[model samples]
Target: MTQPIRVLIVDDEPLARARLKELLSEESDMAVIGECRDGNEAIDAIGRQRPDLVLLDVQMPEPDGFGVLRAVSREYQPAVIFVTAHRDFAVQAFEANALDYLLKPFDQERFRLSLSRVRERRRTGATELDAELVERLESLSSRLTPASERYATRLVAKVGWRMRFLRVEDIDYLEAEGNYVCVHQGKQSFLTRETMNAVEEKLDPRDFVRIHRSLIVRLDRVEEVEPLAPGEMVLTLRDGTKLTSGRSYRARLQRALDLPS
Candidate 1:
């Protein structure tokens, strides 16, 4: 008789934790050891319970999911499956060699797939955290901003045969290209593989504003805001680029610019 895999669910939202619990309950070879609502509790639970696996959420208040991982003593480290709603962290999750990266609203099939990986690792007694994975997590954690607290200050992208790191402040504006975003800085534009909505999450709301469904601009770069048709406006950038604001986004633009709506 094999020992059932002990699991811990760490998420701030009760509904999210409950949903994970409900999914895990159906797994015959998995046992729910505990649930934590914040990073502090998660650290304590990981130290005390030593669960075989942890389904962790990336975004929480202060001392977020990454903070929990950082505080845990390496001796008690367990396999991790990062369950996040943001796709921006997927690359880091894979780089950290997480057991799996389960995006939010994932189906039962995806849940089962992650579970199966855990089972296989347990059966082979290969659940210990590797040095490379530990290094990657620490490195990436230092770069990730806790959800709703801060935003990314830089972006990493692959271009042709080389990689590029662009400073967020250097970017003048953003344009949505289907599922990709084109980050324009000066005369160069780099394509990043993320939706406009996802790209928006990585930018500081105070520094950036969305004027259109397909456009986001640095607030400080705006030269003028001109009224167009009813519920419409046009933004002129310092570089003489003109972009129209979406009717639905007009109110936000007005409020941001302190202009009459």
Candidate 2:
């Protein structure tokens, strides 16, 4: 008989950790070796226990899931299965070369699929994993966490040597101003050193949409989207703010509205 695969479960949420442990216990071929409630504990447990597999949660207070991975010594690294609640990070997670990602509230079949992949890797020999791939995965994992969360919920900007935290939600729109990005909220405007593209990626897609190469607007704040002459379009916000839609983004705006055009 083959040796059972050893597994460790890591998550800050008690119920989530308990549910995963219960699910793994149901598998005859897998054994639950340990459980951890935070990334720091996960790092310590993984180094001490050296489980063959780890079911890791992406979001946790301090030293999050990615931090745990970073702390793992290359000689004792285990196959990782990332568990996340938000879909926004899926693309980035895959790009990190994660063995698999199981969205929260996963079913038995999905868990089985992830297990199968781990088994295949174990059978093939863990040494076969490319070193470059591991490094790239580490890099991508570090980048996967939203910048806003990494830095601060709000950003501090320097206006003539004065710095202040601008609440992210208060911003009406983001605009590219030369090398800097201008943030407008109510009657206040501030010039931030961050680029528009970087800011766009960090903002929640559901709340903010890029209307033009240089502009991103808050969706809930938008009051109306009007078709302009020929191929052009314009959007009006609840604050009576108006922004023009670029040709490239017209289809996206239409899809959001469920409009035929």
Candidate 3:
């Protein structure tokens, strides 16, 4: 019989680790070798245990999920299934790069789907990490500025055959357009194929705030905020443009503006 797939679970949350351990217990084809609570323990476990797969958390303390990959690339490259509670561009980055991930609070069906994908890849003899995988992870991790802890001050977008660089401060607001984001700056607008949450990760939270699920505006550009109704507000921009805040995002908008929550 084939050996059970050796797995390592790494997450800070006790409940998260327990849930994963519980789920893995039902899978006869997989075996739990160890569990880690932080990046340091994970790094050591990955090096010492040499598991076949690692369920990693992106929001862990220093040497985060990406850092763990970087540190292990030179020695071992285990199949990774990111188990993250992170609500940011990182999730989209992983998806866009074709990496498997299980967002937090995921249902059992979703969890099974992720495991199935990993199993399929292993069956196809494609379990090894390739150069492209490393590059993809690097592309997302490169945005992290440890010195400043901010992602980026400028964004590079594709415009037809040309590339455009838009500084974060120059942007008035961003709108979600299906699988893309339309960035408006004064009279010009540029479109990029990225999720709003992903784009939000590239911005400074103090400088920008999401007013709606579909909208993110520069805090300085907001001229006036008017209450429309319960859990709704209309914001007028400095350029006379008006946008309404989403009910779900009302509390966040209020907190961003230091209003009574």
Q: Residue by residue across 95-204, what tens digits does model 2's lDDT show?
A: 22337778888898988888888888888776333445445544565577665565324544558745566876887888999978898888889987667776775576
lDDT of 3 by residue, 1-261 (tens): 989989999999999999999999999899999999987578778978998889998767654676567557454677888876644434554432225777788888978887887787678766465557556545564564354554456665668766577888799999999978999999999997667887886688888999888899999999999987778999999999999998888988998888776
1 versus 2: better lDDT goes to: 1
Predictions in order: lDDT: 0.79, 0.75, 0.78
- Candidate 3, residue 29: how far the Cα is off, in Å: 0.7
Clashing pairs in 2: none
Instruction: Quote the positional error of residue 209 for candidate 1 in Å.
Output: 33
For model 3, the local distance difference test gives 0.78
Compared with the true structure, model 3 gives a TM-score of 0.51
lDDT of 2: 0.75
Model 1 lDDT, residue 139, Cα: 57
Per-residue lDDT tens digits for candidate 1, residues 1-261, read 978889999999999999999998998988999999976578768977999899998777534666566556756678888788866556664533336678888999988888877777776777465556546654565566444455667665559755577789999999998857899998899987667876686688888989899999999999998888877888999999888899999988877777764
